[model samples]
Target: MSHDAIVLCRLDELVEGQALGFDPLGTGKDSVFALRHGGEVRVYRNSCPHLEVRLEYRKDRFLSVDGSQIICYAHGARFLPDSGLCVYGPCLGQSLSALRWHAEADWLVLEAGQLEACAP
Candidate 1:
């Protein structure tokens, strides 16, 4: 991993179509999650655009039953996995704030500076 990046998880640890949440700064609420879909990884802030609530209904439960979209159980918002675009619920046309990350040898690392800029 790069010296300046915050390692989130190993690339091999993420299962396809699943989301994993993390608190890179050790903050309890301003968390982010990563989804691996169709063999690619996408990351987003956990907050729901409509209400500023966490997207998962339960721990790491961010994807819809079919694993085709990211679902915010707070109000039933659904977002496109690849783009974080909300396609359903109150936040339609809005998007989840994406976090910048890159794959290293066997890990996923969040851009260190970007994490600070995203602080609430």
Candidate 2:
């Protein structure tokens, strides 16, 4: 079966150590966010394991002030940007669900099958 790539953003559009949120599947729920850190881009489901709450306190605000980690403002959980490993907070040792994605030319595309897997 063939699937279409869900474009998230252009490589030049996203700044390093920052993040952008999107609802690529049009699920009506903003459950995905892409983080660019250490010269790499990583996408993850936005739900926090602690309470399954959305990670950002504000829209598209997923990273900590210093941009060293992904922070769950709901409970102050801190996760490694590259690995999504929760290093601190109530849900220690847990991780955000990483989604499959790739950079093609200058666009970041989320794997269509992976996006379907995240469907409700």
Candidate 3:
């Protein structure tokens, strides 16, 4: 697998502002969150800086009230959509770690390190 582009998910699977987690290429842990905002597809490491844990109420579901911000189910923290900055919560001004990814053709190109790490 190439670190430059490793398929993670389908384009149709990730809608605008919707986020999902995938195994990064080198660890058993996985990151989530993909915001389809500002006419762009942005992804981030699915972890709260404050707690170092995943942020989601359900599998593959990361949303705040009205889907406006990324909320952490662990502590009710909220993050801005565009910048992934912590808008309201313990880690104010902090942001989730982002990863380079995109959907090209029918493949979800992701970093190889991301997948190899999280592969079970």
Residue-by-residue lDDT tens digits, candidate 2, 2-120? 26778888878778878988888788777799978998889999889897888888888999888999999999999999899999999999999999887788888887876765565
In candidate 1, list every pair of residues with a backbone clash. none
Give the per-residue lDDT digits (tens) of candidate 3, residues 1-120.
454566777766767656776654535545555667656677777778887878887776777656678888898789887778998889988997776675678656766555332233
Counted clashes in each candidate structure: 0, 0, 16
Model 1, 18: alpha-carbon shift in Å?
A: 1.0
**Candidate 1 CA-lDDT value:** 0.86
RMSD, one per candidate, in order: 1.6, 2.0, 3.3
Summarize candidate 1's per-residue lDDT along 3-120 as a digit string, tens digits.
Answer: 6799998988888978888888887754888888999999898889997888888788999988899998979999999999999999999999998888878889888887774556
Candidate scoring better on TM-score of 1 and 3 = 1
TM-scores, each model vs. reference: 0.91, 0.90, 0.77
Pairs clashing within candidate 2: none
lDDT for model 2: 0.86
- Comparing 1 and 2 on TM-score, the stronger one: 1
Error of 3 at 92 (Å): 0.3
The Cα local distance difference test for each model comes to 0.86, 0.86, 0.70
